[model samples]
Target: MAEISAVSEGPRTEGDDYRGIMRFAHLVRADLPEPALAVLDGSQAILVSTLYPDAPATLQELIAGGSAALDAVRAAIADGAAVVHELTDFTFASAVLAPPAVLAVGLNYAAHSSELGLKTDAAPTVFTLWPNSLTGHGQTTSWPRSLSESVDYEAELGVLIGTAAKDVSEEDALDHVWGYTVVNDITARDIQFAEAQWSRCKSFDGFTPTGPVVVTADEIADPQDLHIWTNVDGHMVQDASTNQMVRSVRTLIAHLSQSLTLLPGTLISTGSPGGAGYSRDPQIFLRDRSTVTVGIDGIGELTTHCRILG
Candidate 1:
C-alpha cells in the first residue's frame, strides 16, 4: 500500500529556494494544460493534457523525485505547454487509497442527536471506517435494501494530516494538516440503531464518498468558520455552520493526538450537522436515483448519486 509521506531530506539550501530552484531544474517546454492528481485503475498518476492527447505520470514516479516532482508539475503549468482536458473524461478511485485509518465522529450536533433519540455523549463519539468504503466524486453508491432502508447522509468536512502529529496543542494542530476536502458520511440509520458499533454500518462498500478536489490548508484561513450544508434530490436538507461543531478541528486533533500517533496522510472526517434525511418531518431516506450534494462554503461541493438494490 502506497501512502503520501513527507520526504525528510532537510530543507532546500539557498541555491534551491523557489526562484533559484526553478532555474536549476527542468521546466515543462510548453503550456499543455492544467495537471490533476488522478489514479488510473489502481496506480497514482499525474493527469496532464497535451496537444496530441491527455497523459498521466505515475504518482510513484512523481514522488520518486521528491520535491523536484512537485516542481515539475508546477513548471508544466507555468509554461502553459499542456492542454486542459475535462476531468469528467476519466474515472476515479479514492483520493488517498491506503490512508492509515479513517477516523469519524458521531453525535457532534445537538439537533442530529435529538432527532435520532440519542443524547450527546460527554466525550466525542469517535469510530473508524474501513478503507474499502471509499468511493469517488460523481460515482453512484448503492446500498442493500435488506441491510438498510434507512441509509442517510451526513455532510462533513474531511481533514488530511500532512505530518506525524503527537501530543500537539490546539494552536499547532492546523499546522500539521496537508489540506481539506468534503466528505459525505452516508450512514445506515437502521444498522446504527440495531448495532452498538458504527464501523460496520458506515463501512459498507462505497459508504464514504469524498472529494471533487482537496483545497490545500493554506487556502483556508479559518476551518471552523465555513458553511456546511446538504441537498437531497435538489432540495436543501442540512444547513449549518462549522462553528456549531461541538468540538473544533484544532481541539479534536489535539485530543486525538494525545492518545494515538497520527501519521501523515491520515484522514479525519469531522462529524456532520443536523437536518438529516432520517429525521426529517416525513423522514427522507435516499431513494434510488436520489442525488445528494454536501458542500462546505469555501472548500467545495461533493455530489453523489444513490442507488438501492433489492
Candidate 2:
C-alpha cells in the first residue's frame, strides 16, 4: 500500500494541549486526495504526519517503529501538535490499510463447528484472505449472483501484531499484540463447500470489511472477555462472547508463531462464534442490498453494505 502523508501544510506546533484517549484509523475526507493516518480522540481526529514530518505514514510503519515511536506519538498528542478535525467530517478507510498478511482462524468455536456440521480440527483451521477483499467501514461489498447465493457473515475479533513473533510461548503471546479491531469475515457458503481450499471462496473482492477503528491493546483488559455480535440490518443475528472460543487468542498466536514469524502489522482474525446464517433454521444468507454490522466491545463496529449482481 502507498504511504499517505497528511495534507495539512503549515507551521507545526508541539502537541501539548490535547490530552485524552488515543485510537487510530486511516481516514479519507472530501478535501484530501488520499487516506491519511489519523489519531482519534473521541469524535476528533489528529493528523499524525502533521505532528512530525517524519511520522510514520501507515499503521504498518508505525508498528515497525515499535514502542519508542508509539511513545513519541503519544507524547506529540500530549503536546497538542497536529491539526484536529471532527471525525464525522472524514470517511474511514480500512483500520489496517496494509498488513503484511491477513490470517484467519476457522472452527475455533465449537458451537460454530457443530452448527455448520463441521468438526473442529485438532489444530486451528487457518486460512489467508487476499488483500483485494479488504474494504472499510460503511463501504459497499458487491458479488455476482453467478458466484453463489448462499453468502454468509462471520463476526470475528481481529488481532493486530506489534512485534515479530516466532516460536513464542502462550504466556508471551499477548506481548506481541499491537491492538485489536473487528472483522466481518464474509463468505460464500456454496463455493466454500465446493472447494477444498478456502482462500478464494472467502477472498472474493470486498469480502472482508475491517474497521471503523482499531483500539490499542492497552485499552482492552482481556481479549477473550469481550462481547462480540453481528447485526444484520436491524436483527441481531449472531450474539456471543469471545470467551466461548475453543482456543484463546494467545494460544492461536503461539501456535502460529511456532511455524513462521508473524511480522508487525499482521492481522489474525480469530474465528467467529456460533449463530451463523448458514446454520440458521431457515437460513439467512446476505441478500442484495443487505447491510451487516459486526462489532466487538472495546474494539469498534465494522459495517459492510452488500450488492449482488445478476
Looking at model 1, which ten-residue stretch has the lowest summed lDDT? 20-29
lDDT of 1 by residue, 1-310 (tens): 1122222222223332223111110111124332235312111122432212222232223333444554555565445343333322344445545667789988887887888888888788899999889876667899878888889999999988877899999999998886677889999988888888999989888889877556557668898899999999989999999888888999889989999988776889989888998888799999988899999976666778889999
TM-score of 1: 0.78
Cα shift from native, residue 175, model 1 (Å)? 0.3
Colliding residue pairs in candidate 2:
15-79, 15-80, 15-81, 16-79, 16-80
Model 2's alpha-carbon lDDT is 0.87
lDDT of 1: 0.70
lDDT of 2 by residue, 1-310 (tens): 1123334333236644444355788888778877888887555677888777699887888999999888888887766445665554577788888799999999999999999899998999999999998878888889989988999999999999999999999999999999998999999999999989999989999898887777889889999999999999799998999999999999999999999999999999999999899999899999998999999988777888889998
Question: Which one is best on TM-score?
Answer: 2
**Angstrom error at residue 167, model 2:** 0.5
lDDT of each: 0.70, 0.87
